[model samples]
Target: MEGECIHIRRLTEGSMSYGNFYWEFIKTNTPVIVTGVSIKWECSNWLLKHGQENNIYSSEINFDYLKQQIGDRLVVVTKCSTHDESTVSVEMQFHEFLNYWRNQILSSKADVNNVTAPKILYLKDWHLKAQLPNYEFYKVPQYFASDWLNEYLEEHKLDDYRFVYMGPKNSWTPLHIDVFGSYSWSTNIYGRKKWILLPPGEQFKLLGPRGSLPCNIKEEMLIEKSVNFLIIYQHENETLFVPSGWYHQVLNVTDTISVNHNWFNGTNIKYIWCNITENLRKVMNEILEFRQYVNFKEDCQQILKCNFGLNISDFLEILCFIANSRLTLYMKRYRSKDMSGNRKSVNSHPDNFHIHYDLKSINMLSKFIAQDKIVFNCSTLYDRCMNLIDITQEIFLER
Candidate 1:
């Protein structure tokens, strides 16, 4: 069941708009290279300030300055070989991680036992943007700014999905999909990475008979050797837009650092709902003993809430937020006028994509909320949605 076609398209910067990105890559669930998006980022200059120009990408990225800025904040790190949650995490100061990153590959000495030592420190999932919202290193592209996950999370003072990844050469992540089946963008702020990506369902075929994907893509015991995967050698100042549900494994080609964000908007949120429901059903079936309860379905949904950070109520609330936001934006777009009171045409706004996407999303969410067999019912949710619809007609349609 390995895929036979592998493609990762490349697009240029300075001319690409959100419309171009949406229609081409987002709609198609395809990965693309966006060059020069981070050209003006201060992080790019920081990447160069610490090393020779020819090797700037692999340079230290002014680690001393970053160390001072972040101070002694402890970061979570994993051993590359132990990729599962069962893997123990070691928390160390930020300076220690950087010091180890600089020396992980370079340290060499004559060993008394003549045996090579393995470096297992892998800095993974450091939520830098959430911690430092005012960090002025780089700006997110307009195409990715309408992020519901992190925006909602940030607004509610919850943990966000924005993260920074740093690791020495040979440190690699196991193949996995992004959280909640969301699309992700990773920008190489310093150094290079080798990405191996498999589209949505192809990753399942690479799993062993026990039904887990290989922990390491380069493992000798890989279940399927011929699985078709796109290989990308990502360079500095470049961004990789990974579409939703794609399973990707990354290898640091140098002592590298990058910015990563996981997001899902109204257009592609159906995938997220489907992924969550599917997982919920699987877990429910696996825990059959819990079926004895009077509220089995609610129990399952609660289990999903604990494990996945989203319950049915949480899902509904997110839908309500997005629907309300779209209602406001659409009404604003509808009512825009000049000083002469003449209505303005909406073609000037790139956000015209919202109507089609938003309608489809609202309809889907509406159908789900209207389901009689749902886990729980909230009259307030239905009332809020109805009021928004009423306001939409009153504000946008009524002349």
Candidate 2:
């Protein structure tokens, strides 16, 4: 029931190549803290230092100016938890949330072990990328840049998975998994956060009937030996990558602001596909009489599409999109006079490994998913995926 404790490590761009970045971290699905990221982002310095001297993260971000800039948009804020693992939230204009946020900062009782009055508030999942693209607050590091979810969403002209989070000390979100089993990365611009991360394959042991982790992560920490997890105290300007399927709880150790994105790429696509189909299958099996009706599986797929954002066919489309794009680029590269070299082990150049890895990985995934029972419901789309796979293999051999 227990797994190895997560390795606590840090890296800078100068420390390792992207090839090692993959084999050491991405391929192993481990969490790491990365630094020297070229995020020399002026937004962090500019916003953090509004006008007066700053506080957390040493930023001068002025309270009033920011309120004036983003106040009218509706924001979602949660009042401090009254029930275990269930915090109630309300939607109000951004300015209104900041007013309440200011009141919490003034009433903060951090010195007191427990302040029972005036519950704290947390503003979460603000779609900053869609609403404020010109901000250009940060750039994706090469280590985590192969993000297919955001890439696909952008291609379709939809809102991306990027989000901004802000909250005062004592605000927290309960333990939960990322949507669709996607990998996630979060970077703290200011203040620090305490993270409790549990590995995959162990969530069912902790999940309650409502499918959420219902116990206090702090309480669970008291018995950490019995329940293994990673305790990460993320600090200023540090980035944390959470691999697919990990369950995590985050608490603002100080007044804080951060940006995060959830993305599924070639590295974790199968995990994403499996999570969706398994959940859909569970819904169908739980309602047996419902299954006796005509086309029950397909009906369940429809419901899942509306709720979970994807089913088998849509998942295949993402794979094909990336595969074909990579194929096209590689063909161009192979035809060039520069690439007339012999094939070598994948442990070569950082960029070269990505090409070799992508070709083999995509071909394997396409073949495996094509044979899955869930693909039986949609013959035409599945056939197209196989054809795409064939094209991928053909182009790969031609190179």
Score every model by TM-score. Answer: 0.84, 0.86
Q: What global local distance difference test value does model 1 have? A: 0.70
| 1-399 per-residue lDDT for model 1 (tens digits) | 454446676777746666666666777777888888787876665554444576543355667777766667889998776344345679988888888865654563334452666566878899877777787777887667768777778878898888888877667787778888889999988778998877667676577798777656752323336566778889877899988887888888777888889998866777787777777877688788878888887788788988887865676677767766766776676545321111232223445556435644666555554553433354654565555445433433333
The candidate that wins on lDDT is 2
- Against the reference, the lDDT scores of all candidates come to 0.70, 0.73
Model 1 misplaced stretches (Cα beyond 4 Å): 1-5, 50-58, 82-86, 108-115, 218-226, 336-347, 375-399
Candidate 2 residue lDDT tens string, 1-399? 453355568877557766577778887898898875635854465254434454422453356866655557888887768346667788888888778777666666453655456567788888977887676767877788778788878787787899888888767877788999899998887778998888776556665678766556664442453566788898767889988888888988888888889997767877887888787787677666787788887788787888787876677777777777766777677554233223344335544555555666678787887787767457876787688679767745765
- In angstroms, the error of model 2 at 372 is 1.1
Task: Give the residue spans of candidate 2 off by over 4 A.
Answer: 1-7, 36-39, 46-57, 68-71, 109-116, 204-212, 219-225, 337-356
Give the TM-score comparing model 1 with the true structure, all chains together: 0.84
